[model samples]
Target: MKLAIQTSSGDYALGLIDGTGQLVNAISRAPDTAAAKNIGTLYSALMQKAGKETSALTGVMVDLGPGGLSSTRAGVSFANALSYGANLTLTGVSALEATMLDAKRKTDRPILAMRPSPGGACFWAYYEAGHSVASGCEAPDQLFSRLATEGKAFALAGPLRRIGTEALRATAAEQIDIPAADLACFAKTTPILPITNGTLTYLEPITNMDGAHHIAAKDLAS
Candidate 1:
């Protein structure tokens, strides 16, 4: 049995899949912050629903994120701990790569993935012919205009769909929600990290500021 966890977005989900990447059951919930506290309860509940124990898991999967820092950290931390504890195989999933995969489910047209950055401009990645072409940020006031100039109709998928679609002034032909249970199924068939190293992927640098004030706040939070 395979278990998957995704906290890369506001919607957190736990998914289970069989050896053939078939979904057994999945659950989702949205929590705005402090994902660290309740993930254990959620995981236990899901396992109970599946009538399985955590040790029954043969492999584990997680979304190594470019989303909210705390949520992503909590998920990865949990996956790492579980992998280290149970000695189960683990793999990391990239949200952008998944977006490209989801886009390919339809027409073979080019794909554009955009995720909102910390400031104003969005982080963008593109794929064509089932391969990445380029990835960068959209120029100021040109997020929509740049796509218009691409001269080819493109499919869209990612966490930033709502804001990105609004900026485009056009409706998306396709927008994939990360919480979709099938993502876990697809991960089974997809090439993944051969071993779990407990590392994570981040589009924007993951940093903990160091200073007296920063340390004080972090300590207090802890």
Candidate 2:
């Protein structure tokens, strides 16, 4: 079994998946008890409910994000400690990839996945032919206008849809929400990396987007 954690966006979720990547059980704040502060306790409860133990887990999967800065840091920190102490593999999933995978289920068109960030910036990724073509963080005003000028229709998926403008909606073929169990499924294929490389995606302020690159997971520890 594998353990999946998604705490990006300030909402917490834990999922248990089998070797085949099938979700065996899950707990989320939306339907479960509010247990964010006591994740270790919650994890124990989840394992008990699933009739399993930590020894059964093969790895840990986490959503590395352009998300709530403090929350993302907390989640990744916990995941890193758990995987290291337990001698288990650690896999990281990006917010862009989660949105892209969710959008692909609804349409075959190219996907534009966006996650809103602090200071009026957004983390965006463009995918074509099932591969990521470009990704970066930028102000929505400039990003949307540049995309519009390209004249290519895209299916949109990500947290941005909840707070985006009508003009943003009009630019997409369709928009969909990121699935609640996104990391659980995406984790199956995502490569495992050393605990040293298990870093979270950190989105800096819009002022720094001009020089931004995909930040490494290790950088966040410093």
Candidate 3:
């Protein structure tokens, strides 16, 4: 069975999924520190729930994010180590893609997934006709301005939904927030290519110093 770990949010989530995308057991818990303090606990819970040993894992999936810097790094690090320890292949999935997949279930309209960025902007990806059109980080105003000029009817999904929606509304653009659970649901269904064994890819760190510091504090607390 495929094992999945998502640490893109405040909580660390672990689950097992069969070939058909059926989630066997999923558990989530907040970390006590950025160094994967509660990751062990979550894994243990998942193992108990699934009634399986870690050595039996077929593949591992992890969320590579545009979220809290320290937490993201901690999560990715933990996943990397776990995959190595278990001798399992690993896959890295984009948080944005997961959000879009979740939003698509609600509407076929163009989707714009937005995650809070350190720069007081939002990391965004635009998916139209089931294909990615654009992906980048930009201020909500700038993004909404462009969408307004283009007259795009896109729904917003991800952590920055409120920020994106409010900005879009100010510019008279249509937008909606996709729930977190929906995003997780979409992730469970999507197929991802596994990363080469032993390969490590680091994501871009948050650019906002204050935001990074804030997340760092949270990470330390957790």
The lDDT leader among the candidates is 2
Clashing pairs in 3: 32-222, 33-222
Per-residue lDDT of 93-151 in model 3, one digit per residue for the tens?
A: 66767777877777888887778776577777677866666666768777677677667
Full-model lDDT for every candidate: 0.61, 0.66, 0.65
Off by over 4 Å in 3: 31-36, 161-166, 169-174, 179-222
The RMSD of every model to the true structure, in order and in angstroms, is 9.3, 6.2, 8.1
- Candidate 2's C-alpha runs over 4 A off are 30-34, 170-172, 179-181, 195-222
Worst 10 residues of 1 by lDDT: 212-221
Clashing pairs in 1: none
Instruction: For candidate 2, write residues 127-188 as lDDT tens digits.
Output: 78767667777676777777777677777778755547656766655677663426555553
Tens-digit lDDT string for candidate 1 (132-174): 5666554424655655554556776666443544555464445
Better of 2 and 3 by TM-score: 2
On TM-score, the candidate that comes out on top is: 2
